[model samples]
Target chain A: MKNSWLALLLFVPYIALAIDTDKAFEDPEMQARYEEITAEVRCLKCQNQSIKDSNAFLASDLRREIRRLLEEGKSNDEIYDFLVARYGEFALYRPRMSGKTLVLWIAPALLLLLGGGVIVNIIRRRMNMPIEDDLQEPTNT
Target chain B: MSRFLLPLAAFVILIPIFMVGLTKDPSELPSPFIDELAPDFTLPSLKDPEKTVSSSDYAGQYALVNVWATWCVGCRQEHEFLMELSRSQSVPIYGINWRDGRSEALRWLQALGDPYVASGFDQDGRVGIDWGVYGAPETFLVNADGIVLHKHLGPLDATAWERDFVPKIGGGS
Candidate 1:
């Protein structure tokens, strides 16, 4: 019992830290929207983490702002526009398709096609090369 | 031989681009509001809670809209510099007390000296969102025409003022 009690004490602090306890919308639809938007929004303070995953104060504030805007009947697109207007396209995890972002969207496919063409060309050239006769007498024999 | 060298040349070109990306601070997201008109907002004044201040009040002069909060450590770091700048009276300074307790914010200014001509209480940080403030201690320099001239992230000091603000204001200050 003493050992178990000590173990519980050690685990209690982690349990406290693990609980988010963030306020949730009463409406399920709004809550869903909140979750979706939070996931889509990048946490500027934690560049790699989504707003939903970040513990930064700015992320929390942004989440709260999103909730408020949702409550005010603002659509998801409007909310996104609001953030983009302020933080620029960097706020969006999936950047919108535009002239500036066209290269970013197309570069991977272009590289893949280029690489495939090179590999195909190399293989074709090797096949076209004269093959050494397997039945030829060993030169050093 | 030229075909093989093409990939090497491509990689060489990408090296500098990748280096630039790696050196940039990812947390410092660029504001889209640069060179655009400052967003309009009306918030209650920190001094007199009953009275409100609007963005229009900053019209007709170069001003600094400093976003700060009592909870933000960076704001505390930059407070002394703001106080000094306020003393210079070179330009009007406005405050957006973002998402902070009203009493605590008032107490902070009272203790440190109020630098803002009118500190707007952005108790909910909505105005701050409009201002494209991702972090506290971000300062925006707005021209007389209400257009945002420059936005400086992180703490502003004398060196930053000379480098970032002086050129925009034509070295007047």
Candidate 2:
């Protein structure tokens, strides 16, 4: 009961946006897929804004088109493929993993590895160095 | 030697990382619409009766074409900047009013002072669509040849005026 209530509370803000997708609720799977797809694609004319955030005519047209395609029972992959073919990769904010975009994909991972390597090198050097106490000893002699 | 090397490497690496973060995204270049021939349109004047304005009117002089709407808060915010810009510059400033009413737009101009040489009313937003206007508060700096020299998206603030606009156009303080 608590989990369901928590889910409802979490979804309250999104509930308003849900009204715009009236046709998507025909099937649970399709609704989920519709949300997933719209969340990725951006509104072309709007400045760095997603289609979901934009109230522009183009955004609305894209939304209507997505709904029409969904009603036609097109699979998520098929819809994405169609859009990618038509608009090119610029349509997506979170761009697809591809050979052309490999640098963008690997950048964060590369930075992490570089940072880890530096930390490991520092640790190794610190471990290998003799302690100041040891170097200054022979006080017993 | 190891201690010195570690700190030196860290210092070098840290500078480049900070530099990378400061670098603007090159792929998302500033307004690719610049230097192209200004898109043509004739729109009604919100203030006057049956008066229409077009791009051809500003054929031989550098003009600052500002896109604004009475409904936009940013437009109101930049009103003073426009006033200041008009006073300081020799170039004529024209306005394209997007998705607004005549009375409301006139009221805004009355309350804030009109900085435009002439303003065009894009009542249905079709004119805006033709000019590639995605939203209000976009400005285009057009050269004497009717070619756009620069396009500034979003609001024109003090920093933009001082750092970008003034130097490029040779305008005032």
Candidate 3:
């Protein structure tokens, strides 16, 4: 009885993990599509969690919808466009490049360039100042 | 002085942007369906499962489509206010009884009061997804042409109706 209880205790976590697994898809291609789409779609109820990771009802509904769309032979872009049309761009984990999101995509590179320029400018100024100091040192000597 | 001024200006400019980001609720995402034609769906009536209700029933009239569930605590909180709104008859209210047991929903309406013209039973929440409902207790205002005017998340109160809804409906509150 004690050995059986220990075995059950060890098996409990695997059961919990299985709960989040997607429903069985008959086609392997459809299963792959399901995995890819769920990973990219954010659970709107839990903004931080992907639909695959979330247990929210909305997430499950979205997963089922994705499966249904895939079965209907809709392309990935069409699926994404459908979700974005209803939930807005926020539904996508990787936002598309558009007029509104142009800044978001460009800002990181712009800031890095600006920072690098500042560092190079400071180093050049330091190098030039040291040359002037070296020249004055000879005079003192 | 010039060196300090550049960073100072950057800091000053960033403060307001950060403040706006901090004040805004990240959970309250903007729905893209606003001003777009409301998605058409045919769902069974909660009371009579055999009969169905569709979006076309509310054509040529401003209507409120309220997504609710018996299990959602927020729905209970807003039920009284919905009842009051139904009594006023300012706009016809339609309910999407989303992902709920039929018997529980029917009993809930009986115990509180039926506020909807017809409550659609969304057994699997397919229609709720079409409406872009992330959570329960989302209310959408549909114009006469079946265009979604606005979507309000969370429990609605008198203040929310006055501020977010009244002006859109052209009724001064």
Candidate 4:
């Protein structure tokens, strides 16, 4: 009974590690393209998960669509265009810079600059102030 | 006072943005096909595979193209409203029976009330991808020019129909 329990625990991990290979292409290059696209495409059903990681029906359908597009000799940009044309820019995990997304792309750098300005200002102000030796406790002299 | 200026301005700016975002539905994804020509497709009619259904059928009139499946609970919830719309005859309701077993879909229409003028059997949901259908119970409004005007995700109710669809079609319905 103890051996069976140990075997069951081992079996659980194997099931979790099982790779989904049903939608793979015959060509290695095409399969790599398939993997790349699926990983980058956001599953609409589960907004945070990539299509490659999601088990949603919509994700599976998108995988099938990617396979078909690859088989049709579509380039990466063309495939992205196809998805964006239908589902909008939100479908892509890495969104391209556009009019609406200009701020989103630059916000992090902008925030860093602002933070750096504040730090510099504080440091400069501190340098200008005289040190107060009386504020510190007298050491055992 | 100077130290607080940046945060105060950010608060002022972000307040309205957050308020606007809160009012919007996260699940309601905006489709890119709006005001563009609807994707053209020729599919087999769900009821009788011998007959064909095409996008051109909606030309010369405004129509509702609803994507549904037997497995979608939202589709079932909105079914009565669809049947009611069909009976009123203001606009024809077409269906894309997406990614569903044919027999089960046929039985659903029979059991509930058949609202669609013709439901296209999209066996593998390939056509659905063209329509930007991520989930069931999505309704597209196509104008007489065959341009897709609006896409409504989730079950259609009287409130949604009046608020969204009615104005676009010009309040007569």
Candidate 5:
């Protein structure tokens, strides 16, 4: 009887500790979605840090809000819509490729093509010219 | 000719090993949570008036740093875990108290516990902002190299310490 009571005494606190463990592992689907949205959201306080990377109170609250929303069965689009309505489009880490963002999306490719064209044109001009004749013509002139 | 063939064969055989090593698991990339260097700042130490501490203060140690404010209830909820972790590991624990009254912070540390080696008082939270801290009770595991190796967004607990952190870093459970 004493041994059983001793085991019970030891086991009770451990069992209580184990009860709290579920908080860390609870709602796998919700947790995964929480991660996705946090990654997508930008932290306003930190320069260019995603909510996932920030440890600020606002970021933490936002993350908890996301988790709560997910637990309430809100879809990713719905969560994003809620955030956009509150914080505007700047809340997203990857700004959408829309009309206003078209420049942001296209400018790099356009610049690359322009640069390549200039280089190719210069190379072709150099190749087409007769170097020896060009030098001789300049000297003759 | 034989030497060249052997070298070529060795190169061919080693390619797969090299590729496997280079293509590490995405999950293992040190969650953007605490992958970067912890931001540097010298804040007044809560315990000592004249002394100041910064990220460089823990340069040669494997430190678990927690950011919390006395006003934050979540920090209180995670208090036991911090105490447990401190007791369990030889690693040092440091705290950055963000935007809280200095007296309350000191009182809380005195009442609940003081697992922290030193606590920084970030009165304005500018240092917290620089560290990318959005909330209270965010914890970072910084390697000896001063690179943040892992981050726990919410409260810390035994299960998280074992499953997520210890296994990832090959530390004792």
Candidate 6:
């Protein structure tokens, strides 16, 4: 069909955003921090995608907001606090240390101790076995 | 026999945990503003852009703040219920017309019944961002002290109104 060119216009918005996301941050370190922060924060509506990776309108809004905060000289911790204060801990890809999350944070150590206890119990039971039992021939008589 | 029993016990425990998770809507985020002061804002009124509405205007009164938009399908689905609820006069409802055209919102409200006492025109959605509004049709129940008591993330229906808002208000559904 000769009219297929009109279908390509649908991609204009994506092209616009491609140019927008590449606009540089003033300081290189700040840019690195910006990239890390965006990658770390979850897009609330699009739960699986980080803000850096999402094309959702809400994600774009968040990216703009995060940049504004960065420009205002807010630290990454302060930005996290700001997001968590409004959106709750769900926005954080990595949860903070808190009473509610204590079990999650300590689970690995608990599992390690449990595994060690099982191993020690098995070794203790084996320690009493005779080492010379197989050395002698069987007496059929 | 002991090894089989240990895993059986773990399986029994996991059943209840998984069942509880099944009933929850994973898309719903836990409301962080519950028992906290409702975030403050003053935006142009949706009905008349020249006049502004502020969160403080609803202070000293129990109110419902609804986030909506002409572009949101959920908002359209919930509009009829909102109109009916407005007729009942149980509580005053405020609105945030988020990231939507002021003209289109006004036209929609005019064509449909106006449920919100004062709707804020959140043209750029900055106020919505401040309120942690990730989705449209989120509702907040605020007490007379201006503390946000509950947040309903999806469209309001009779079931949620009875289950969530009624218990908080201590009223018979």
lDDT of 2 by residue, B1-173 (tens): 66599779889999998898788653342443466677788988767759988998888878889999988887988889899878876678999988788899998899889999889988766666456565568888887788777777778878886775556566421
Task: State the DockQ of every prediction.
Answer: 0.66, 0.10, 0.79, 0.76, 0.05, 0.70
**Fnat for each predicted structure, in order:** 0.88, 0.04, 0.88, 0.85, 0.08, 0.77
The clash count for each model shown is 0, 0, 0, 0, 9, 0
Where does candidate 6 stray beyond 4 Å?
A1-22, A123-141, B171-173
Please give the range of 10 consecutive residues that has the lowest summed lDDT in model 4 chain B: B164-173
Native-referenced Cα lDDT, model 5: 0.74
Highest TM-score: which candidate? Answer: 3
Residue B109 error, candidate 3, Å: 0.7
B22-102 per-residue lDDT for model 3 (tens digits) = 999888988888889999989999999899988988988899999999999999999999999999999999999999999
> Please, what's the RMSD in Å of model 2?
8.3
Relative to the true structure, how large is the alpha-carbon lDDT of every model? 0.88, 0.76, 0.90, 0.90, 0.74, 0.89
Clashing residue pairs found in predicted model 2: none
True contacts kept of 2: 0.04
CA deviation > 4 Å runs, candidate 1: A1-27, A133-141, B1-4, B171-173
Ranking by DockQ: 3, 4, 6, 1, 2, 5
How much is the lDDT of residue A67 in candidate 3? 86
Supply the DockQ value of model 2.
0.10
> Candidate 5 on B1-173: residue-level lDDT in tens?
76488659879999999999888732221233355666677899988858987778888778888998888888988998888878876678989988888899899989999988889988876666556565567788888777778787667888888876776556522
Instruction: Please identify which of the two predictions, 1 or 5, would achieve the higher TM-score against the true structure.
Output: 1
In Å, residue A25's CA in model 5 sits off its true spot by 48
- Tens digit of per-residue lDDT, candidate 4, span B12-76: 99999999999998988988899899999888999999998899888889999999999999999
* Candidate 2 residue runs with Cα over 4 Å from true position: A1-40, A43-49, A53-141, B1-11, B15-29, B87-89, B124-135, B153-159, B170-173
Across all models, the iRMS values in order are 1.2, 6.6, 0.8, 0.6, 9.8, 0.7
